[model samples]
Target: MSPGYLPFKDALDLPAFFCENCGFWQRHFTRPDSCPLCIDSRHVMPQRGWHFHTVEEARDRYPCHWAEVEPGVWRFFNDPIDGIGSSGYLIQTAAGNLAFEGCGVYSEDALALIATLGGVQVLAASHPHSYGAIWQLQDRFDPELALHPGDLSWSGALCVSWPFDDVLEPLPGLSLHLTAGHFDGHTVLYDRGRHILFCGDCLKFELDPADARRATTISAHKAFVRGIPLTPAELRRYRDVFAALDFTQTWTPFEQAANSGRREALTLIDTMMATRPHAYPVPLETL
Candidate 1:
């Protein structure tokens, strides 16, 4: 008798690999030595050293799970800190399902759950850091991966089909806009109908997460983990883009899915502003 489950490599017949340090997936016939993104300023080398894994290893290592963020939005993630720790989201619409933030691990079980949700028609992410095994997701679902040209060099795998710039509306009521704070070509997705902003790594969520629902205690950074801060001008770009978006709640990879505070998020750039020439943006003094 044959086994019920298909092997990882056999099931998803795609030439893709992932970095154990960052969890960003790339396509290659055979595993290449040294990941470029890991050595970049933003990611840097992990203290444990370079750890690479095949798609099969990723599957065996982590157990994938998901939860409903809203009626049409769902969060798919892998528990336990395997890599940088990221979650992918699925926004179901009549136009088609959009997989926001590529999920890291791919399994038969993961596919089954997605099938029940109308299947994915697109895969997109704000920046490289939040991108999991996107190449795998694209191969499995046969959806166009919406990526910006600014960060194309960071892609370990060449799976991008829909290269958009500035702004794009791939699906009905869903718009992708450039934020470009944490990483160039960093984009945020706005669900016009749902009024939620999927603001990837552009904003860092504080550890405590007191309210979880409100977008307080969040900070913008050039590199949050490395203490790198974005310049005042960069923050200005953030302000301009976010102010134009008509979102009530914000979703970030640094934090779990929640209905974030509207006013709190909209005014985040304002609150982070202060006297210039400081190491980081200082809160303004109330005179």
Candidate 2:
């Protein structure tokens, strides 16, 4: 059953709100006048003002789509994410399915498919921008919600059960790593068995045209639209965590996985540091 407008929290008629600019799905009944993420300089607040969608409006606007990008790895999202941030992921695991991030839109079909795969036992995100319709998922699955306490200030109302700090292996072969630069608690999911790193917002990328799912340029950023570069210490922290990983491929919130290895990952950081400290990303041509 997809979310409809009728059973809203109260008669105030505010229902749940979604920030179309940054994809922050706030489920609480109280309507906060402005989106907290949009107010921050790290994220650009559209001049047109805060664009919000009610549950019913969002479901009608964004259609549901899902695919197994790789074995045991699935991505489900609605189109026109645009600047709303990245899509959510459903990673099938032996312990249980882990739902990382939540699609801002809801679909009955997506919900039913997930049920057959065993409803999500764990739910988490790299940051608040990707915390789409998590409340809907929490309501439906009652999964164990997790968030690094660092981003807890931004996570509204959701009950967090298993919060991970530096590292966590909540499920077999699936791990979470904190590499805070984009935000104080920006994290990445590492699937050890597949040698893939879910980059989250920790890194920015442009997918190659020849190979729609591949990336030729990978860059680091404190904020992409603002063109802010991370401080040396923050970038170093990212390097350290990624160095420990043995991933040959990477995936961002909006883009598909790219054939980038650990060496290319480190070189991007090194190139950024040694030469252009102020440059958003050292530019793919130089890398």
Candidate 3:
């Protein structure tokens, strides 16, 4: 069986709501135009996504908890409102453990938890915006940094940084690919042993338990609505880059896991490429 889903209330103090139209839940807010997911516009609106484990309660919930999703694969959800934003993960390998993405806050307890496992050897972030507490993690583990060269400017004043080239062989079978969609240096990790792809925010998790058995794909629609840095043309190019990967299951740090068990990653890439461009305020009521 796959991992089960839990509400944000059980995990964090954040408000959540379920969208009847898409069957996705988002955060509840006084502003109708607020988007809790992308945290941008009302067109995308915030829907309730699966809540993972967290630490603390009330205003004290600055740091969140981590979970072991699959053997050797662990995920950490950071508390957003506290200003320590985005989720990250730790993957155990024969050499040592590797951490992907940065969290809002890194505590001694969290560092100890990672050290107790096997100790981290490499720290990587998919994009600059997701570079939560990378500097702190690096100071703790002092591991090799993995990031896209295109986003080097984003890592301002960081003493240690490395460019993500073709494929990185941090371990025997694990490879890190710089997909370059959501950001110039966005990355995804492919574990040959598990055939799982850790896509750091390049894709959003669309939750539908009833269709969990089927392959799931993300929509560029949200990106379109938010007026993100990427244009439709640029997005299409990024989609093409993601099309080259071979992954069975896709996991996002804070959302539901997608079963790309059968379909190729190219299928979703093609879908996004073919969709027609449109303006925001997409009448979510109609979608």
Candidate 4:
């Protein structure tokens, strides 16, 4: 079957290849020879061989459900699932509901919850791996799945591609900044109205999340390591892009979030680059 061809009913049941290396889900009638997203050393390949899992295979063990992460934000997570622990967010906005990422795994409960919170109007991902079960999501919800023009080939289906010159305003007060790094079209959603930055692995947070003082500790090292480290040029460009935004709380696809204000988050990036020196360093010229 061609990509994005699954019917709404069949989509939720279609078999998809879940790449453990990059945490991406691409649905196809037959598995590809190799994971497309992992080809450029963007992700590590499995030593044993390529492994694929169907939605049905995982639903029993890793049930899908939703949780309220913040006042208006809800997180959809799967328990006991293999590969990277992937989570997607649904944020309530005046314009409509916005989802940060997608999970290949879906459930009736999740669909119900999404409907309860005003069905998602737009679903955007930061990178290819974060595309989640985009094909399925499109079939089921028919929401606009935003992708970067540069990463279109990385997509399994025909995605709604956007250009960097034109900013995306999914909602009245929310905007998505398509920055370069992990992928040429990597993005981070910023809610200008509430000062909340939804970073989809663009700005990674490093800390013992289990620690009680994780938020207050400024020593936590947070770098933009999606598949490869950011180049000095890309780092400087991203730094300036973020430097222009004012956000209080920033959240990622993983379990890391920075609540110490945007200034502090920016400072941490500066500190990490200064200390690491090798991977990321202060740039003399901006891109």
Candidate 5:
């Protein structure tokens, strides 16, 4: 613990605690003895050792800021302060704005921008790692923050009120669907009208072959994904899960958007399974 660090007991009532080594906030509950995100190889741990930081210290070190990446959508990023380099977004809709992704950084400028665009009505994270400085945002904005029950332990005290079901329709065209891949609780936000899916890391945009050079590698699927390695049966199940969706494009935690539609997305999944037959073999029934 550092000088500004608040003991986990003190932060038990807060939404999350910052793991200095992991450089991200984990929802606090009983002051976790260790960070779940870091201990898991998916996120990787810090070299030095484990340490904790207060939300205040993180905000002071790295102030939150934003850039409008698309119509009615703002992208937020900060490096030096936000050590994990996670990016979040503010999506404006007819009903209200949705803060997607939690970066443990808040700034007055961000507040002003939200005020100007209409304050966020709901808050969410793509996965455990993006659960940034949510407490700070919640404290300042007072929005209905939604956390998946599967990931609740990570969201320490911040008074998690809204737990999501398998499917949640916060706005008219906006729906959040729980899709397992990276984590059992991983979710994706679907914009029905636009046919755009905010898939976090569960489904990622892959580079287009048209844009690839001779050095470009090709694959059946065109999405970048990371998580616990899946067994062939598990991978096929996941493919079936995503294949049922009716979406034209997918946006991930990273900036790129995969214009490939549901067919392409499914192809990518099948291709991934084929390439790693030993690890992800197709079942005989399906064959």
Candidate 6:
């Protein structure tokens, strides 16, 4: 089935409403609108839940792990399952800091690392599936939550409160582009200074070094998987979107050897897009 398209740019003019029950936010279109969380009967909704957490709680819950990607750019991984490392990033931008792809489960150690780096000023995700602990990060840092307009509908009630956008210049050295591959709203972060890309699930891992350029079968990382219903044609469109991006390095949220291997990572993604079994076949005209 074809996925629904959200007019995210249009929703920007709408007013923000919050739900007392679930602490989620939504757009107030009418005098008596229902709360997205509890669907409250009243029209007036609260706004406290958008980022519900004290500074201390946020610091204690979310821990950060750092990796020197190049020079000034660093990638922070949020270890979700304790031992199994998942993907998350902390880029030191001229505009303070930016976090790409957050983990749902975090620890105090992670939070401390984030704090040491002067805290996160903007929280963004590659796609809906990667939005594991975005609400938590927003609450802790109170940064603008930048998301791809294509995936805005996935935000649901939370979309009402946070500021959404198609593209944003979070920092002078950083820019995020919408690259629909794994999900329609999937995005990739580009670091101009270091030429590094933080790609969540748009690309898969190539286990074999010799066959690194070939697409291989692998299970989707839970933090980067989405439930969006996609047709084969849509998948092809997504692949096209990602192929257009000019990137030097691609990083995942895990401790995979592929993260540091740029050429291998790009080759794996290229093979997957060109030869993978599609859920729906692309039209010859489009190809």
lDDT of 1 by residue, 1-287 (tens): 11123344343454667788888776666786767778888776877776777878788887788888689888888875466778888999998999988667857788788988878888889888878866666666778778898888876464567888799999989999998877888999989988888988766554335665543355567886677877888888888888887776678875653544345554556655764312243221221
The Cα error of candidate 2 at residue 93, in Å, is 1.4
Give the least accurate 10-residue stretch of model 4, judged by summed lDDT: 278-287
State which candidate has the highest lDDT.
2
Q: Show where candidate 3 strays beyond 4 Å.
A: 1-61, 79-84, 209-217, 221-240, 261-265, 275-287
Q: Candidate 4's error at 239, in angstroms?
A: 1.4
Runs with alpha carbons beyond 4 Å of true place in candidate 5: 1-17, 26-34, 204-228, 274-287
Model 1 pairs whose backbones collide: 27-157
* TM-score of each predicted structure versus truth: 0.86, 0.90, 0.66, 0.81, 0.76, 0.57
* Residue 204, candidate 2: C-alpha displacement in angstroms: 1.2
Model 4 lDDT at residue 140: 64
Give model 2's TM-score versus the native structure.
0.90
- Residue 222 displacement (Å), model 1: 0.7
Per-residue lDDT of 117-177 in model 2, one digit per residue for the tens?
8888888888877787877777789787777889988866466777778999878898989
- Over 4 Å off in model 2, which ranges? 1-15, 82-85, 276-286
Clash totals for all models, in order? 1, 0, 6, 0, 15, 10
> Which tens-of-lDDT digit does each residue in 79-153 have in candidate 6?
323222345677886678887876544456666667887787777777654554455555566666777767777
> Relative to the unseen true structure, what is the C-alpha lDDT of residue 228 in candidate 5, on a scale of 0 to 100?
41
On residues 29-141, what C-alpha lDDT tens digit does candidate 4 reach at each position?
77656677566555556667777666666566567877786778887877766665567888898778877777656677788778878887777777776676555555666
Clashing residue pairs in candidate 6 are 18-46, 62-111, 63-109, 63-110, 63-111, 64-110, 86-253, 87-253, 180-238, 232-280
- Name the weakest run of 10 consecutive residues (lDDT summed) in model 1: 278-287
**Model 5 / residue 143 / CA error / Å:** 1.6
Clashing pairs in 4: none
Model 6, residue 3: displacement in angstroms?
30
1 or 4: which has the higher TM-score? Answer: 1
What's the lDDT for all of these models? 0.73, 0.77, 0.55, 0.64, 0.63, 0.51
Estimate, for each residue in 84-104, the C-alpha lDDT of model 5 and write its tens digit: 566677888999888887655
